[model samples]
Target: MIDTAIPHKPNPTFEGLKRNKVWLASITILILLAILSPAQARFSLAFTLDALLHTAPFLILSIAIAAWAGATGADSLIARVFTGSPLLMIGLAALAGGLSPFCSCGVIPLIAALLSMGVPLSAVMAFWLASPIMDPSMFVLTTGVLGTEFAIAKTLAAIGLGVMGGLVIYLLARGGALADPLRAGIGNGGCGASNLRTPQPVVWKFWTAPERRAKFGREAVKTTLFLAKWLVLAFLLESLMLTFVPAEVIANTLGGTGIGPIALATVVGVPAYLNGYAALPLIGGMLEQGMAPGAGLAFLVAGGVTSLPAAIAVWALVRPKVFTLYIALSLSGAFLCGLLFQTWMGS
Candidate 1:
């Protein structure tokens, strides 16, 4: 109030930023030096293989499903309906989540891209809440790694949590707290053709018409290409994590201590961002080595919800407050799900 006309001077030098860069570079150099030893590299490679094995099945399935959703307009239909009704959206999201391989990190980029292109918040949230636990990759890997009992328990737990999470979000933002950020950005510019209002095409009546069939086929091709463009990078990044990270380290860090595993999994995953496909084999190995099923679930849920890229993409549309709330909501749901698994299914 006293100095309204005075200009504030910002420091011109990026010294703080420079220091951070130097520190990060030093750490990377040290890690590389350690890996230079053949023995250590071999050990690292073994863990990498386990991670890759865990990730493979889920990635393949999720990509396939995403392609299907994109081509058939299922994603757009689901988004439109779910955005209007959070409860139904959540249930659908939870159910779909159970069968996908995107994990938290992998899901984030793809989901964020979908949201950017007009997917509903509820469906996106559902994917966040459920995908890690529900995938075939996780089911198969955990069954082999931790036993059939654990696998069955995990699948049930994921569905339960996915439904509950979606419900909670719906209740919290019932009157539109969860507006579509991408749609908001569109204003009147017609950003997302997918999100635009168009005359309903006559479906059954047009089924036999060659012109309609051709149009539908063209739309399918376009949608598939759009989704694949966003997903390819996620797949490649997941592969890199699988190739380099140590499964033993993850297992040990996330293994036990009751809820500590859940909390640590949520926190640790903020950066590591494991793909469900890549995460499965590694988690299986960990369970084989005595890691708790609850911990594995936490890793899966938290890792999917806290992806860095997803956060960045979402921030573009929603305010920081909404994005932070989204993260908190997603993580809390994941944590609760992990605990639920422990409470009901633990050995």
Candidate 2:
């Protein structure tokens, strides 16, 4: 009982009229199309749900880490810690990396902040290399999926690799072969007045510094936007890899000795941006299908350390060669850790 005789008044604006017509035409086409391909429609919905499953954990971890960094002043603390003696810095990095659940993606900003705060490059490298493999989140994930024994062994391997890598970087860094745009007193005039930007006044002027509020908001916004943008791409790619690529292919290709494990881990993981939680279920599935524990461990560590987005984030702060070294160091550390896990720990 619609009034088809009279012309219904539509939005007079050009843009509004275009929008209405587009919506109507789209709905009409969809209605006709639905009658033709119901099975395809159902498949599309299922595929979407599976993709969401693959992406959810990575998204959650990234957002949570961003929130934590904003809340805690961990960035500044890391920077201050980085300013210590090279040996002490490396040790601290190993300790901090061992404990924190933060991944490479989340750690980049913290390292940048640390650099701004004056932490040594070696220490930052140590942390970047180890945290993803040795952190509690990764530990729980490895233990739950692989086993407690595997997790413990993996942790030991991470620590050993991290320490050795830190020492190597510390020694090599003295030659100044690597470029470090983030070195102390380079940018922002040694983190003095330049970093202390425009201030916003608060209720209690005497109690709190206006500078802190301004800096906090700026950093929070910056970090959130940066992480969020990368996370979307990471999520999409992760889903694509999980859904399309056969797990067996990955396992078969990456498994075995003679640096095959390391090479495969690096090549595969450099592009696969997975957080600790996002990886566990997928890894569990792979392991059940006969993926070697050591190879799987290597994949997890490499994936976390060599995340493309995280590398880019870090490259924004440091120079290209340093970033390249970071990738090489993380990949090497992951492979060595995997080997050690396979060798030393009791079966």
Residues 115-154, candidate 2: write the lDDT tens digits: 5545566777777677766765456545654578877876
| Displacement of the residue 178 alpha carbon in candidate 1, Å | 6.3
Across residues 251-296, which tens digit of lDDT does each residue of candidate 1 receive? 6767764898887766766676644434555455555555667777
User: Total clashes, candidate 2?
Assistant: 4
In order, what is each prediction's RMSD in angstroms? 11.4, 9.3
Q: How much is 52 displaced in model 1, in angstroms?
A: 6.5
Candidate 2 Cα deviation (angstroms), residue 268:
1.8
TM-score of 1: 0.56
Q: Which portions of model 1 show Cα errors greater than 4 Å?
A: 1-35, 39-86, 97-124, 131-162, 174-253
CA lDDT, candidate 1, residue 299: 69
TM-scores for every predicted model? 0.56, 0.59
Candidates' lDDT values, in order?
0.56, 0.59
